[model samples]
Target: MRAFREDESRRNAPLTAENATRVREAMRGISFAGTPPHWAELIAENNWMDRLHGVGQSSSRS
Candidate 1:
């Protein structure tokens, strides 16, 4: 998540519109595979069902 935050910061930094778009695209392709380096607390709980089926978590609220 730290990497994602850093990428987000870089994307938001002052830059040409074209450059910003490229950074945004690059960040969109970034993924966190395997075990994370740190055990940071997740803001939302995750279920193994989604992970097993390769489906990402939905943003829907109960």
Candidate 2:
């Protein structure tokens, strides 16, 4: 997600419509596969369904 971390000035700036579109374009076609990096953490409680589908806990803004 380091790539998603906007520069300090940009992050502090207002999220205008144009900026939102830019973010969407930047994220397009990106996908995560294979083992997660060591810095990743599983925030959700252990569950069977997720395990069955290979889904895992994730943290995100509320």
Candidate 3:
């Protein structure tokens, strides 16, 4: 998930895009209401799913 965070190009992409819609769906009600290093993982993980077309990262950086 952290890997995705570093991939700023994708991370900064609009959440209203199609892929972002899919990401939000997978998140299934997870709130995007918080600060970094906290909501960071949730947003990154969801974004990662969208980026890879459903594939998840094997490891996360700390």
For candidate 2, write residues 1-62 as lDDT tens digits: 56566676666555555655576588787889998776555544355456523421221111
Model 2 scores worst on lDDT over the 10 consecutive residues at 53-62
List candidate 1 stretches off by more than 4 Å: 1-13, 34-62
lDDT string for model 1 (1-62, tens) is: 99999999976555555654576589888998888655444532365546523322121111
lDDT of 3 by residue, 1-62 (tens): 78777798766544545555587588887766556575557666767668656333311110
Candidate 2 residue 52 C-alpha distance from true site, Å: 26
Highest lDDT against the true fold, candidate: 3
Which candidate ranks first by TM-score, i.e. highest? 2
Least lDDT summed over 10 consecutive residues: which range in candidate 3? 53-62
For every model shown, what is its TM-score relative to the native structure? 0.33, 0.38, 0.26
Residue 54, candidate 3: how far off, in angstroms? 24
* Candidate 2, lDDT over the whole model: 0.53
